[model samples]
Target: MTYCVGLLLNEGMVLLSDTRTNAGLDNIATYRKMFTFEKPGERVIVIMTAGSLSVTQTTIARLREAIDDKDSTPDQSIMLAPTMLKVAEIIGNALASVRLDIESKMEASKVSTSASMIVAGQRRGGGMRMFLVYPEGNFIEATEDTPFLQIGEHKYGKPILDRVARMDMSLDEARKAMLLSMDSTLRSNLSVGMPLDLVIIHKDDCQISERRRIEKGDPDFSRMSEMWSEALRDGFTKIQI
Candidate 1:
């Protein structure tokens, strides 16, 4: 299990993902769940994945291969796709293909191969867009009505987003919301351990504005988490109901 979340706001976008992957209580390890591709002033793409590690890793590998292939077309490579929508399609198709291939080989074992991804990016002349791509090559875009997308062990972290996320929030606020969301997931679920990966991309920049990796016991994150816990406790005490 894992947790990854992305927010698309009027000012920019913020993304976060945990690095822990576990096969069992005794077999936990860290593998980055966030990946980025960029063409600096032309385009930028960020993908956060969850579910079967085999499927997600293979899909990402194939996508990179397509980008490097001399014969690749827009339909076959996300970097060559003309629109964010088309990029989502390319990623979805790749994920579905990889999942199916892995599942077939694991059929005799009856192991599951389900996976999903949050695809977010901007083209030089196009609008910023975000999509939650499912295992079957279908996807849903983020809109004003729903300015955020999440995958993996998301339930524990969704309430804060529901209450405070806004399409007009500043980049700083978006980062805070994203971090708080991840903080919540970490406290509630052991499967979603840290060393987190965070990315920020400002509107129309077509490139990553900031990136950071928060390792376990990071001072700033620890302070923020402590502050949030205290504030919540204070609010709980003040509630008349």
Candidate 2:
């Protein structure tokens, strides 16, 4: 299992993902779940994935191969796609194609080769956009009504986002919301362990504003997690119910 979330806001975008993948109690590993494609100042695209490791890795590898191909056109490469929507289409198609190929080989065992992704970014002179792409290549974009997306062990972390995420939030507030959201998931799900990948993009910057990896022992994250727990306990104590 994995956990990844993306927030789209007026100030920018905030993304976070855990690095753990667990097949069984004794079979666990760490693999990057976030991939970024950028031509700094021109375009920036960040993809966070969940589900089958094989499916997500191959889809990303193939996308990189397409970008490097000599015959690749603007439509064929996410970095060159005219708009963020087109980029989502290109990624969705690539993902579905890869999944079909994998599904064919795994038909006998019925091991399940499904996967999903969140694609978020902006191109020069264009508004930012975010999409949650399903295994079949279809996707849903973030809207004012729903300005965020999540995949994997999401249920454990969704309530905080539902209560706090807002389109007009400052970037710092968004980051804290994302962290607290992740904290909730970590407390409830053993499969969603850290170190986590965090990326922030500022509106119109067309570049990643900041990127950080929060390791298991990171002081700030530890402090924040402890504070959140204490606050929640205090709030509960104060309530009549």
Candidate 3:
């Protein structure tokens, strides 16, 4: 019940995620959905999560634990994984294991405990890569044919991405594309709300080039939303049935 999107462009990688989590209409709260891991110029990995908070949080916690463990190895810690593909595999396996454990423990209550994540990053000497990690320890990478991946209340915002995004898009344009995509979802879904977390990592830089938190009523975002609304209305008026 949240929206998180990542774009893998020739220029860099752009990521955005809403901070809203809702147990019910009256039980809404803001919890950051974006997590970043980096060793400055050496490596950088940004994870945007959606779905059950318990699953995503635990998966991240375990990853961090491995990173901090003095005995961690390439197979155990994502930061030490030789390649981004191996990192995704480790995360997928961790996520699947945590989800299964949680589901088993909650069997008596018959609750669902599943989640998915978008894993994007680059190593100092490696190329930028992005993947959509599924709930069952499997994933698909972003390719030139589709240089983007999204998770959560994604249906409401996918149209704009499909119509406008491309592999060669500039970082600036990619950021706008994702914000507007999130804007569309925000307007149509109550489960997804502000503030939004956005991050941009320039290719091979192995560090976050830009990061921002857009809170509710942030002037710039508000203006963009209003402009989009007016444009939509104008477009509707110009159309003839």
Instruction: Compute each candidate's TM-score over C-alphas.
Output: 0.98, 0.98, 0.98
Q: How many clashing residue pairs are found in candidate 3?
A: 0
lDDT of 2 at 42: 95
lDDT of 1 by residue, 1-241 (tens): 9999999999989999999998778999999999999999899999999999999999999999999998999999899999999999999999999999999899998777999999999999999999999999899999999999999999999999999999999999989998999999999999999899999999999999999999999999999999999999999999997
lDDT per residue, candidate 2, 140-226, as tens digits? 999888898999999999999999988998999999999999999998989999999999999999999999999998999999999
Q: Please give the range of 10 consecutive residues that has the lowest summed lDDT in model 2.
A: 74-83
All models: lDDT?
0.96, 0.94, 0.94
lDDT (tens digit, per residue) of candidate 3 on 1-241:
8899999999999999999997768999999999999999999999989888999999999999999999999998999998999999999999999999899888898667879999999997889999999999899999999998999999989999999999899999999999999999999999999999999999889999999999899999999999989999999999999
- What RMSD does each model have against the real structure? 0.8, 0.7, 0.8
Residue 76 alpha-carbon offset, candidate 1, angstroms: 1.0
| Candidate 2 backbone collisions, by pair | none
Query: In model 3, which regions exceed 4 Å deviation?
Result: none
